[model samples]
Target: MAPDQTNSADVLIAPAPGPGALRHRLEEAILGDIASGRLAPGTALPPSRTLADALGISRWVVTEAYGHLVGKGVLEARTGSATRVAAVAPVAVPDGAARRVAPAPRLERAPDRATHDLAPGVPDLRHVPRDAWLRAAREALAGATNQDLGAQPPAGHPAARAAVATHLRRSRIVSGPDDAVVLTRGAADGMSRIAAALATAGHTHLLVEDPSWAALRDAAAAAGLTPVPVPVDDAGISPGRLRAEAARTGARAALLTPAHQFPLGAALPDERRAALLDWAREVDGLLIEDDYDAEFRYDRRPVPALQGLDPDRVLLLGSTSKTLAPAFGIGWMVVPQRWRAPVLDVSVRRGPAPGPATLDQLTLARFVGDGAYARYLRAARARYARRRAALLTALERELPGARIGGIAAGMHVTVDLAGVRVGPAGAGGDDAAVVDGRDGVDAAAADFAALDAAAVVREGAARDVALVDLRRYQAAPSARSTVLVVGYGNLADARLPAAIRGLRAAVEAASAEAAGAGAGAARAGPTGAAAGSVG
Candidate 1:
């Protein structure tokens, strides 16, 4: 509340008591006073009936408000001592900026959601055919070889290796498979192997992608390789820049996701693909091709695996991150003949441990070899198609004009909101409703705000309908509006509409809040002038 000419800043909103109005207003006023410190925490509030008479409001209204406060523990309403605030410190206001709402909070926490969860890499669970899995499990236990289960095998399951080799040759059309496939954990395991191999190859630097997976950048640095970022555009990293960077840093290997790039969602094009292979051939450098989530193509026909084009230069890496399950931890690295020993040696130095448990490998091999893997792949493709369609439709309806980026292949997609306007409170908060129009958040500024979250990434976790405050995945500090990287993997088709409704509610509430805050600040600032502002 801002004072008009008299330099007084006080706002009192008390509705006349007709029925419930008095009770509501009184409660609001009491809470407001307690929050603003007009009525100090320890101060005794007037007894219900007595205060009601004095204030000309009904005795029950005053009692009701006091009762409400007492319930909140704001008032003790003790048997002897006067009503007092609870001993506990002031907790965060609901949906208010009192605490941090980051990665997980902003993420929709419900698991066990979605039918065709095709937001990239998640395999069709329908393919599991529970009955088959159960049978395989029984068989695995019955036929348990004398292999130690206390620690993992250095080389993965011989049967799994053989199965993978057979699958690769038939499906990916790779050449001979009568060689070593040192399995560690997953693709991540392979990356570690490559990192170690590159270090021993006497290469001090690793050429990287600009908008690549955050994991790759971390892996390179962990392996003692300087990650020299090579900016990637649609065609993938310009071959010219790749050559220059490799020459500049003597980069030993380039970690890439050619078939389907991460984050930016670029599927490597023909010319660039050939040029990249040429660069590797010319420099005798290694290319770690992450063929992680290439199986779930929706909009276009499946792109051919790059490893088939140049087997020697490209160490094709594959994982079950999207195929089976992340928990299964099944992955493999296919190294060229000469580098096979070095790859295995690096794995040994790093305590080469096979990931997917022997039992799991046995099960997966059964799943794959029994033609169920292909069946699940086909099923997953269909489910993801629906999920993708739902996402596109929602964006089209709610956030019209949002530039949907990324190759229409994968579990996640990005929406660029450069043209739209979104504020800090999000679309569902009412903080801005009290603003008097100047420009700021006085209510927030006067009391508290945790760390300035403007520095972190948010909203890229899972797809939600209410995306008003989703600015997490956007390039930082540009104020390029708010972009949302939505993962459709977790949403059930039936629940999406409700999610969109939630998004709208969040944004609408946010708008009202912003207005109110602006108004409230204007009523209380700059020596009682109309100096209110809200963000």
Candidate 2:
């Protein structure tokens, strides 16, 4: 097929979440961009790496964010060309399983007290300025304008669009000020809108990271876009693999986290990023950039965005959710010049932002307009940086001799049990003391995976940093082995020290048992299959 006639679904792409369960915050971000013209309908988007860098986040975060918008019909994906903002309303999502929220698991009563809630992906609510939020809300209500009282455009408030544009330019480096902003409630809304728009253009299967964000993969599946899991390494996804996958799946785009990959914390290398972009160009697919948690760099310098490398080929996405708080739910997209119309059309279909919330827009505008956004980011970077240090310190104190990974930037990091040799379940080469009398097998894997492995982790005798195994990040058919992802964002300062200690204790116990088991295993054979597996 000629490149122009290439089917959007021909190159494989990601999807979005259920339209109903998505919060208005996502709509606010996606529609806001469409309204402000940051992503013109029919315009191309930057690769996910570009968007991630520009916004200081992992590409997966941006991918999910974009998926939310796509499901809502705000953006369109054209085959072999680019993902574009739609000028029309996206097709309504049928009410389905994806729309329903899952009931929270019943709380398991007190286990060991470990305050490091670094189970990966949980945002740090510690820094949320509740008072500031309340103040902004009250002020908005008190100063309600006529616009605030009435039903508004689905594209959100004009003021919000402007504010977002400014924010994008200031923080995310989104070009096309007048044509570069849209308001969505959060990243999810943005993804839905984008998915819906893409579906309109007949886009289908999406390519996501092998060990990608689960919510995003779910989001795309809900959006009716088939999801294809792509493998990723420390340097991020293999560009060559993406090309082959896209070609095989006939997908319209590839959803990626280039800046800092989700669980592995793999930053997409420049050559790999360029290769991905070239692949998209090759197959007529676009790249959905998910910029998640790029603000808090604990070690090395921050990486540049892939969008800056090639703006037109990538969909640049950003949000205030991570930099601020999740509920703040604000993000924007910078689109190419092609699909602007379809994007606008999708906006109109979502039905005006409820109440137009003029004041919020005003305040947001003022915040970014006054350069507070940058300052806030700087502060957040510093704060998270320190938290990383504290967490690291605590880990050293608690789970000494642990293998820490992905600590260079972002709110989350990885914990590889390969070194510490001790874990909660005694799977990590534990000693003889903590044996459960079950033939002295290392119990770390069984222990960690036993207690509803999906749940948060706890340390034992020989513990580790608070973390959820890397399998949580698996979006592919293949299940990855053991690796823990610990997030510092949600962990409180006061609780961090103790959490580390608890982690240490857990690992100690687990390690003891693991050591006992290892002796058992070594006495037996080499088939004890262990970590280093990517989900």
Best by TM-score: 2
TM-score of 2: 0.66
Alpha-carbon lDDT, every model = 0.61, 0.61
Which stretches in model 1 have alpha-carbon errors above 4 Å? 1-131, 147-153, 176-180, 421-481, 504-535
Candidate 2 ranges beyond 4 A from true positions: 1-114, 131-144, 354-358, 423-466, 477-480, 511-535
The lDDT, on a scale of 0 to 1, for candidate 1 is 0.61
The digit string of per-residue lDDT tens for model 1 on 1-535 reads: 2112211111222332224466765665555555555555455555565454334346676667677767766666668755554544253332221221111343444454332232333443323345556676677667767663446655677777777777777766665574656565788777877887778878788887775666656776788788888877766778889888888888757878887777667888889989998988888888888887788799876787788888888888887767766666788887887788877777666653546677877766676777777776776778778868887887666544457778878777766543322344333134322212222344534222111112112221133332322333222223433444556654544445555444434433433444455456556665655545553
Model 2 agreement with the true structure over 1-535: per-residue lDDT tens digits: 1223333222212222324423343344445444544434564555555444333445676566666767767666556745556667453432331232222333563343233466665555545554455565666566668856677655556666776666555555556645555566666666766776777888889888888887667766777888888888778899778777877989868788888898788888788987888887777667878887765565665666676666767776667677777666666666655655666677778765622255666567656655666776777788778778888876665554556777478888787644443345323344423222232343443332222122225343124345566776775333334356777777666556666666555555444544545555554444544343333
CA displacement after TM-score superposition, residue 418 of candidate 1 (Å): 1.7
Q: How many backbone clashes does every candidate have? A: 47, 157
Backbone clashes counted, model 1 = 47
Error of 2 at 294 (Å): 1.7
